[model samples]
Target: MQFDRKDKNNAVLLDLYTQLLYPRMVEEKMLILLRQGRIGKWFSGIGQEAIAIGSTLAMEENEYILPMHRNLGVFTARNIPLKRLMAQWQGKLNGFTKGRDRSFHFGTQDYKIIGMISHLGPQMAVADGIALADLISGQEKATLVYTGDGATSEGDFHEAINVAAVWNLPVIFLIENNGYGLSTPTAEQYKCQNLVDRAVGYGIEGVQIDGNNVLEVYDTIAAIAAKIRKDPKPVLVECLTFRMRGHEEASGTKYVPQELMDAWAEKDPVANFEHFLLTENVLNQELIAEIKADFKAGIEYEIEAAFQEEEPIANTIAELEDMYAPFNFKPNALSPDAPSTEVRYLDAITDALKIGMYKHDNLVLMGQDIAEYGGAFKITEGFTTLFGKARVRNTPICESAIVGAALGLSINGYKSVVEMQFADFVTCGFNQIVNNLAKTHYRWGEKADVVIRMPTGAGTGAGPFHSQSNEAWFTKTPGLKIVYPAFPQDAKGLLLAAIDDPNPVLFFEHKYLYRSLTGQVPQGEYQLEIGKANVLKEGRQLCIITYGLGVHWALAYMDEHPELSINLVDLRSLQPWDKNAVSNAVKQTGRVLILHEDTLSTGFGAELAAWIGEHCFSDLDAPVMRCASSDTAIPMNKVLEEDFLAKSRLAATIEKLLAY
Candidate 1:
């Protein structure tokens, strides 16, 4: 392709010329700093500046951009202030994340740019979520997601793209296929001639373009953006380019051949664009010199000035703060004269969902077999028919994608209550939960108001895969609230409370208690206090501190032995469990027994016991004791399953605590 300054939109092309120059200049500056030991490390997109700048130009101010480390160029083109970027590189308090993170992994929500995680491809699902938010709201905006050729190999790439295609979401997936994913070449990554060809499997429009050509990239993205804005469907655009430098400053380019390097260097996007502009006489070389000089001066000043700023403080107390969003909500109080119905725990959950959906117009439910099939437990039996499939969705058998998409969806003013089919399967989405959902609020003041309904606890002879009490996995996570209900009323009320809370909540509905427990629940909408515990029975001999199915087990033990008066306390919320309630019970009984269905080692019971020992040491008449399942997989046999966490075991533990 040939370029004539008079035939082209010179103004737009000239602007792109300057935008491309910023990243190139920053890359050069960073490489020098890396060598000088001023910066820790650097990941440069030196050769492929055109893809970053050109695609950014095509996006509107309102559209969202999820940028990877290499796409720092996108930030520069969006005018994100070189000073902040420099300060971030230096770990200064003035930087994004307040120097909590050091690189392109930080972004301001106001900028509509989501920072990337070190783990690639998950953000694709997140971006789809952001786009889905707009589609559901009937907004006229598109989402532009950036990924590298290497990320295309990730499952998230397919999971996200498939959802976007099926929903006809307004999103443009821009892949920077720079010939190499780290050190592995394209031939080894996939057999496909081009990355865009793979998009056909997802049933979306796919296009391949010369990533080195600034005008071609800019024009291609501009058209893709326009098409998605109207028809609201996803498009995949693969930019064929190369990385001139190593993967990062540490990864030297010894694996890259000099011959290939020289060939790519000859067609460098920044250099080639400059030559094209100069040859076409686009306002002469003098103006270009001024623009370069101005950018260089500004970059130099920011780098120097940022160094003089205060180093980010390392305060453990402050860091721990803001881990969870404020748990505050005006519960829709149940009417005094409202009717009560004796409902099963499963029906109570469904009732909560129906009521929540009726109350909040933006509530969405997604999980495998949740819509038409009514979930694996039939908890959502008639949800699709009642609330319609759009609100109650059946997603693919991708746990990570479901959670990732829900995280994205929550960012756009919608509340998502996702089901994990089985609680054991939540491990598949652990990365998204721990890294993305748990840290999102702490890293940036963004809340993913998502509720993951986990059918947890072990009792059924469903073996290791189906039976698991994994509540302990998320108890250590900062930004997540965990609710484990033992009865029908608490199940329904706590779920409603979780759905209303503005942070991610892991609602654990004990599968064992789903049908076994039946109690009269309030007819109208009502939410029990989330972080508070409930004392089902009062006693003076011992305090049984437990929750979920453990509460029922404690009650059964009480029925068996009326001789030992025990105070059964349900710590409904694990993360912010009721310390005050536990303290009061311990003070009265002077003997504490912490029990749960999870394994003994590093379980939630351990935390509870530690807390009691720390805060209620003098109040305890004896050492804090706990009875939990052994640190092994839940057994498939009925005899072993009962022995693992049976009422008999808890009864013996209570008797021992009493004697002590």
Candidate 2:
């Protein structure tokens, strides 16, 4: 029934009367379930049901809504099946969380709505990201993030809000200011009594509405959404309501005074809305009884189904367990077939990037000196010419911001290539890369298709921060691909592969080899690939595993020491490196030597050596070995720089292998 604009009383009666009743009934069932041990805990949306329903009803179906644990009404209204939801609450196999995610923390890939999360702040940032994507991709759908007033104190909340405001993201932040954050009230927590007022600092519109009045809440939200969908700015709506129940089903009762509870209970939203409905004749007592009965039966059906569902199998739940992909640093494999066309490794990389950028409009490039300077090494000198300034652009020295913004951009339907001036500088943006970009897809099942190009490994006299070999640091980060290219042709192929990947990829281009390494690469649109190994040579006596510039050195070593038969493998992709190829070569030949330019303490070489030793234990005549730099910072001294690198130590390690 429409809340006829003509009758003021009819508005509350028809629109919010049932909304209020449904939430109260749901809460009652939630309490019963808690008593029966069918649910672990419950967050009551009790006194503010009208506001919850009103704000939620304002959104389009395709538009995204991310709610906290207290939003059962929103999830149920959105059609998230009650049985699956109850199963999740019961920690059963058929739970909406697929028996993997925590009860009350649910996510659905099919529906746009994100599942509830115990972790408060991340959802705010994630909601903004979804809106950013919609804005960039030209998608009509918007997004809303629902959080309590207390959550505003979080750094992630501020960070997300600031960025969203600055970028004019199509998002709405709905704050349920239900009097307190558990034991503490909003006044004690924040200096500003109004949460909406906080938006003034971020340069966006902020509004406060009466939570008990469903029509007011709905109209306010609808107006804001309309303005936001047109202008696409972040808005904060502070709902003035009260929480009738304790923070949890059985907790917070000790802290909350009964007198205060009585005060809050007197203005009970369900009764207020029901009275309004009756006053306007939108509904009578008989209809109210039937509505309660229908909701009662629905809740009963859901509870029964939760009990009837079968236990989840181990393996199916295991898929949810593996959101964090394992990292195997160096795979046993040969280098990619020498570039078919004669070209430098940097040249192949440039070709691959340019081709991919042109082929897919979503690909974009950003770095400190990339635009006018065309990058420090000038690899991207003409990238802007081909891809245009919008696609190929430069950024400030804010490494953290660059990586964070790129992550924000990726969710918006763009594949970003974020270039750190040097591999050593990745430390600056380490948090954003690992915590945000790397784990986004893992936690939320959201894709972050972006490439981080860090010019790595020490060889030149660049020294210390500029010349550290930090591939192992990134390889340790799960859900991120690490690719190290040695030759020009392989550079083009692997880069092509990284751009096409849906996962975040860390492309560690060797600073020393950018210009020095040369090979054949097709000038046009071909790509090599990521996740495969290149066999530089096949031998019977021993197998040598190397990557990046080490591949060049290994090839040169083989050429000089032909009397010793050693198969060489250049692993192009470090994260998902070719384990099969490496193990196969180790199986073929009993001897294996892992080599890298990084330090020996915890380098990729050590990982490779361990894997080779494990899988090929009986196949080997001798123990596995690694030839890498000592555990020390890259020296500033030109002469000592070369000495400190794996290059100087490599010869001796090779001799040790031959002697054995």
Candidate 3:
């Protein structure tokens, strides 16, 4: 099997050729499989194989690369087993995501490859997080993330690059300018001369390379990577390439002009690289045939093995169990009998964050103006001085970037708590929260151990923009834990527990209760169970189920009406709300009323009422009712806001239920 090439360059050339040829052969085989219905889909990287092969091979083993769906060569160059990759493509149990995701949608930490989600630009931000983790740990590692000419137009692309540039994190923003984005040509995508030209706006170096030339890609990327490691900074490298095939097998390239296709065909990466190697005598006709034959046989064998592999079976319990990592709620540093101090809900949260920082060194706090300015609510006041800027990081006003970065940090052995200055502002980063962070665990078994602190609820007359009880939006999304605490003790305990949980937990802190609610809180570290509901008052006449500000309103209503005995349940966690406690309370009281600050229609209260009606039907003396804010935006006027909230209607709703 030995080749009679004496030149040292021969070995390097052969390695590059083999790496380049493997993915090409694999893609060709996969395309055939797709036509035969053996595989579901194929995103051919036939012409652009050189870019992936060269750039990936140029990086050090410890460094990370986030590849898009088109970069099949990145996986092969990293030497990931062909069989497992085939299994993944075939949706088999042996795959990286265990058939949960297809193709490059899954990331493998073992190989230092962070996979891309469907939203292409978010991975760029994720790369920033990885590089930030390395920088924080004093490692000279760099991250390389890929995007297309089309994805460059996405807001995340700008946010990611701008943040990376500002922080001087070592990152390579590789744009594969493949001319077309699902049939939309580059002419329609942007007005810029080249994708790399946009890099100047972010204050970063920009370079354009002929992506068809593997040697150019390798040399350019290798040099940039070395320079980045020595002096950390972000660089934008645009690989001028073309997609030789349709976006996917199903999408035909009828819109592509015949002449354009013909022109690009002449610049075939695999054929050109082979011709170069042959001209240099590093490879001959016989050697090329042997290499292609070997790759084809290996790919065929793996494909056959992947076909034999079992499809992932749907097990309800196991699937549910896989949604989150095992959460171990730690015992309190102070015993239950220990002396407690009264503090505002805001101070309790601050204390918990401080304790969390002391406990978990890798815990990072990220938000706008959270460091020096002490945040909008001043929850992290003096945090930068106390914990240093590294841990208590003040991020730019880029929610999507920070949220995606938090997921990236979670990927690399760090727990992050992202604070939305206001809960309403979370809509800006909704995709990162619901799609990326929430689905990461279920899709790839990569737990996003991030806590998003949402200062939620209305009553401050902050208007529609600042005041919103938006917990109901995320309760519908699976794989996310939503924790809304009503009191100071619960706020501290639930937040600490959320920080410890190995999943993305949305911790809702009511802006109204932050300073108003004062209660006896344990002085030291303590974490309450996340999904458990606490009963504030025990009664049998009627039951009220609520969380956050609703708990306060219900408590006050019960205090005003002493004759109406009520069982008040504070559902601390919405996603895994205490169903058993709610059902038991309903059965005990024989009447149940669901309440929340969110709008009435399709709110979390509606869900609770439906569950109570379905499960506790026989025990109910009256129909399960709900009291929530009117279906309208929170108004700025204090009187209108009061009227809009469920608090004004709570007594009437409760009395009506009791009377029934």
Candidate 4:
């Protein structure tokens, strides 16, 4: 195994040996600390250091690498100050996530490292996004993303790889097949003979390498990276390695047989590489001792510094501070005196998207059938010809991957607007939207400037799947803005505002209002304040608070009953709803009615009613009333739907509230 001194890769072998040794020593120290109750937990990459070190170092400096919890070598190889990383593990204020998260759950843009969330397979799709950004920007950069053998079974893994292969994206899907995922063995995870063999179905090149061999990993990944940068297609590399320790320090390795552990210990990456360096005369016993001593001292110094740092305290005000990035809404952009034209609600959204594309060069649109087919509702018709296929991408029916990719794009200085063919389908991508996109900024200060276009609400008898008002689901999740506009003008203006805001937004477009609703929209591009509500009419008897279809229902009910002097308020944004406007209107009217298209139980109206009851209880002449549909699945029959809708009983509820 000894290499000749004349060998050109001699220096590289020495560097690799050092990189592999660093994480091994760091993990050993952390495990000792764990046993002493100093640190909380640690996911040891004791035996699999070669995969993280080799794969990360193989990529170019500007390229991105999405590392998993066990990829400690990736962080250390990039030379991220060990003190900062130690502070992160200690839950100190100076950590990458500011103590919002612990371990390798945080990412840093400065190092081109996107960290992994607990959900394993989503980052694979996110890597596609980073690679897509590089390709769109005409940069020859590739993205390297890691996953385990068991996680390869996740739907997101397949979706991500398939999309990257179809689009010829420059992504390296690195799988560390460590034989087990926690306690579940690979035999129980998938039926495939070899994990790398799955690449054939994807029509991509697949390579199987002995992950314990640092030299092999480095050489194979370096070659693949070079090939991908030139050709720009995905390649799957399965690194056959073993987990020498438990999933976490606390989790024992009782399930692993002793013979298997003994077999893997012989192939220890750090020891094996060290032996080779020693045998090659590149390192003597003294030099090896010196390197270990130096690294140990450095780690101890960093850990001490981290211990002296301040721990983050949980404060209500501080908790809400970084939930969203600063967004300035310019009301003057409305241009009320500009030329205007009548357009449908759907057309207004299309116009706003067109304006956004023209305005922001880095803005990208992704969804199923969004490019040539113009999306499920023809909202993006002619967009492909106007904007090109790169920006307006037609993704596979993989909601999770698409949403994850949007977050990845946002991480790399791009704004993304994702279209869900139907709002109900967002359930497939729920984890990405709620966990990844919603928590990115709060956890790591990375703004997910993503807008998910949800064509929601029921009226057209599209059945239970297609016709559900699901805004209430996302309304409960913090760090997300929910905008549901009723009129065409509001839809256009609100959409533009959502695009401009540096936060994840759920833009719910009422499917029923697509062609049925029409209004005069200003010709010039404009942005409206998302958190601001509009007073459609001012009255003194009772206040009707609503948004989306409820706004139209209230207006129609008011038209039918001219005697009811209603103070109608349209709460366009649900997350940061116009609380002041709602309070003011409730005080003015003395009686308030909350209306929505969602089911009665746990609908967004319930929240409004609770808030009004809490804040404006004294102003109310009567108890707060909520008018909503019964708690039942949306029926397919139009007749049944009409009876099921809240609109059928809106007038009666209004009468009851006003009479109170």
Candidate 5:
């Protein structure tokens, strides 16, 4: 193809032939900022500008794109305000996140870019979902997702690509093959020689380009994207790029070979491009000089603006900000307005999901057996038929993928609801939930709207692994919402409320309650605000705090011991706990007891008791006591298992509290 020197875009391209020196210089300046205490850590895209700009040129501006830490080229090319990027580097509020979202993992709604996932390699599914959503909506936008070659090792990369290819979604997966991952070279890290080749397994188009050649990268991607628009299928574009900077701040080039660095730097992208353009007679000296001056001035303005920008204060998240969109407050969920409608517990669970899905379009449901099988307990019976397969999806048997997909999907305009076939299997996604979902919100103020439902709380004789309640693990996560429904009405209402809430929620349903539990439900759709504990029976002698199926056992024990006075309180939610209600009951009763089906020692019950003792010690007549399962993994024997749970021993504990 002949070069069009007269074209403005091509004229600018001539300047960019080795023009990334400006971007490279900016990367060095960022390092200076780190030493001076002006900024925190950084991931530089110094030598990899061609990959970013080249791959980006072929992308539709409206298409969804997920970026990684060292993706300044993607952000810069996409016009995601350069000054704001500087602000983000400085950990200031004016950046895209406004000090709320994580510095690296964020995007502007207006920009149409998505993600910077906490986990290294899960955003692929999010891009796929975006493409899937666009396809369904009849909008012809593609989803262009970028990841390091190192990320290909993640299971999500496989799961997402396989699904995307099979479904024929318009998504372009860009692999920035930057030779090394931190310290490990690709040759040593991956079993395969080329990443693009792996796309064959998924039946997707795979292409490789010289990542150093800017023009080649651009033209090739543009052609591929055009084909994607026509064919509307998945394609893998591998850009063989190289990293010149250290992985993070203060890291050394000690692991990187000096000879290779000197060699690659000699063929520096900026220098190579400039030489290429000059040799082609596409650019003259004066135009190139002017572009450099202009670029320098523009970046200086960004740096200055970033330093002048302000950071957010504490009151913003606690008081000033809207929970969801710009104007409306995310539904201020309501507890059942009155007594239960006298509905079955399973029906309440169904009603809860329905309410949330009805009130919020972003709320979506997905799980195995949920779509065609209607759930193992039929809790989601008819849901797929009502919501359609798009919203209520039946996923393959991959729990890690299921939860990980939910976490990624939440990055877009989605509030994902995921179901664990059994609560015990939640172990499969423990890392995503604990390391990513749990900390993402508090650490970055990023919104991870997810509802994970697990049938928990024992008594079904389904054996230890399937029957154990694991509320403590969720409660340990700082930013998650943990809600356990005790009654039919509360179950439905709280679950709906959790769906509408901005944080991730773990709604642990007691297996025994599926058919056995019953209560009056609200007439219309309703919500139960998270964190409020409901006192089922009021008494001055003692306080019993329990949730899930334990609430029933607590009530039964109260009825049996007519001579003993105890207030049975059902803690519907764990995180953002209702400290006021707990304190009031503790003060009134004099003696308090905390109870839950999760094993003792550092469990939710223990935390509750510890908090009560710490905060309400002066008002209490006796030291707070906790009734929980023995501190051991649930065993297989049914009778011994019954003996292991606090519910089985609640009567004696309540009597002990009553005696106090």
Candidate 6:
């Protein structure tokens, strides 16, 4: 290839070559490390460098890029140092994640890059959130999220794009259809000729291009980015490229056909782009050789220095410290002379949200039918009319996308309180809550100040799907605060506390008590300690530790049997339970009974029993007993529901404990 002195895009081509060279060198260094047994595995974006560099080059500053494992070229395009990545691969203290992570699974707020999870589709929803935040703030920016053909099959992909299209968010979804998803070929994966065809169903513009052509990919992205920045909307770009290596270094490609691999090898993105540069006289033979040699030497030097960096030791105290983001807010005490109004449990929660939104302009409310319909339980009636649609968002039926989007909003200076419609539906969004929302702070010290409001418990015969107390599910997961308040005052106070906290919080509201429970709520703002238990009544014979609807049942049983002397302790928070209060009550009574609305087997009550037995065994006169609903799913029949969480059954258990 000969050079022409007067080329128009010479500087652009040279810059692309410089950025593209970094990732290729990174892959080469990683391959050497993999062979040397220093790295466990390597997911190389060897032939797909053009798609990474081209797409990223089109993005402007402050725009977000959610990168997957195979999109390492984005790092090079963003000008991240090669040594930092090398140290991360080596699991050294100097790594970006400080040895917490070793793969492409990391992100920093400074770079506007979100670290991807092993599950590929969730980041798309997160990108929608990032774009939505900018759109709401009237900022001119877009979010670029990358995925592969395999991720297209995930429900999150559909849910994410659907929300982006409906809301008209400024997000560009780039899918690299790399012929094969690990071992399954595209022929076996989808029936459509092109993945872009699915965009019609989503009502969004879709474009297809030869991902191997760097200029084509770059031009497409640059054009779309310009249009979307002026008038925000989602656009899907399908880049038809092929992975030239196995899914990982150790995973051999026996399933890939030899002829297919050879055909794709002929159209290598890196080689083709370099030849294009030469034919256009953008670079001479000597200059190309020098550029490659310089990149190689630089990578080699970084790798050598990274090997000597000390690896971080696993420390329990450090792990505990990062479990929750620092939250310090000593709320003003409830004014004694302040006017009070009798409000139901549901209205109390609504009042708390209204107060939270009024205090913090960045507070956002999101859920299905929440904005217009005021939620299924009518907890947010008139919210949309008061706060406007921008703050009170009515989301689609996608649970995962709703929560995932809330995480994005949290990072972008918004406090999102997402309602799950029903607690049972939370399982649909479990991955985002457990893996993304629950672990975000622990992994990168980023506070995901998102509150998940769950309408929990059973009494209206809503059956297994609509009625279930699932607080124990989140209590088992770290990096989350669980609050289940039984009274109206506690519900309002705890919800305010949850919103104020600087970490992810799970706020459970018992559907049974929404209307039935009423109390005098303070008119002014106030917050309660999240992990403390309230002692409603004091006695001497036995101590009943309960929460949510269980408190009502325990109180009713005590009223029915006056001879049974007991103290009622309401555990408002499940995760950071009031251990001191529980211990003191058990010591005074010499007998303990734990109660909850969740199923009996492995319930939160079991944890309380274990703690009491282990910590206060000698202080107790009898073994700790637990009373809860049966392990079976909540039945629709009235008789079955009664027997499931029966007060009579609880009374029987209490009698035994008192007799002990």
Candidate 1 local lDDT, 1-660, one digit each (tens): 354343467787788788888888878988888889888888888888888888888899878899888887789878888888788878788887777776888767778889888898889889888888898888888899988889999888888899888888888898998878889998999888888998888888999998888888888888888888888999999988888888987887899889999998888887788888887677477897899899889889988888898997789888887676766677667776779999999999999999999999899999999988999999889888888887898888888888988988887778899999999999888988998988888876788889999998788899889888999889998888899988898888999999888889999998888888899999878998888899989999989999988888888778878887889899899977898999999999999999888989999999999988999999989899999998788889999888876454786787788778
lDDT (CA) per prediction:
0.86, 0.76, 0.90, 0.91, 0.75, 0.88
Better of 5 and 6 by lDDT: 6
Quote the positional error of residue 502 for candidate 5 in Å. 3.7
Q: In model 3, where do residues sit more than 4 Å from their true spots?
A: 1-8, 333-336
Error (Å) of candidate 2 at residue 483 is 2.2
Residue 617 lDDT in candidate 3: 92
- Which candidate number would show the highest lDDT if scored against the true structure? 4
Write the residue-wise lDDT of candidate 2 on 39-148 in tens digits: 77787777878676777787887777878877776776666777877777666777654555665565565566665445476667667656766775677666788888
**Candidates arranged by TM-score, highest first:** 4, 3, 6, 1, 5, 2
For residue 342, give model 3's deviation from the true position in Å.
1.2
RMSD for each model, in Å, please? 1.9, 5.0, 2.5, 1.4, 3.5, 1.9
Q: Rank the candidates by lDDT, best first.
A: 4, 3, 6, 1, 2, 5
Worst 10 residues of 1 by lDDT: 1-10
- Give TM per candidate: 0.96, 0.83, 0.98, 0.98, 0.90, 0.97
lDDT of 6 by residue, 313-420 (tens): 989999887878998869668767778899888889989999999998888899999988899999899998889999999999999998989988887778899999
Q: Which ten residues in a row have the lowest lDDT in candidate 2?
A: 325-334
* Clash number for each model: 0, 20, 0, 0, 14, 0
Answer with 1 or 4, whichever has the higher TM-score. Answer: 4
206-253 per-residue lDDT for model 3 (tens digits): 999999888889888998999999899999999999999999978989
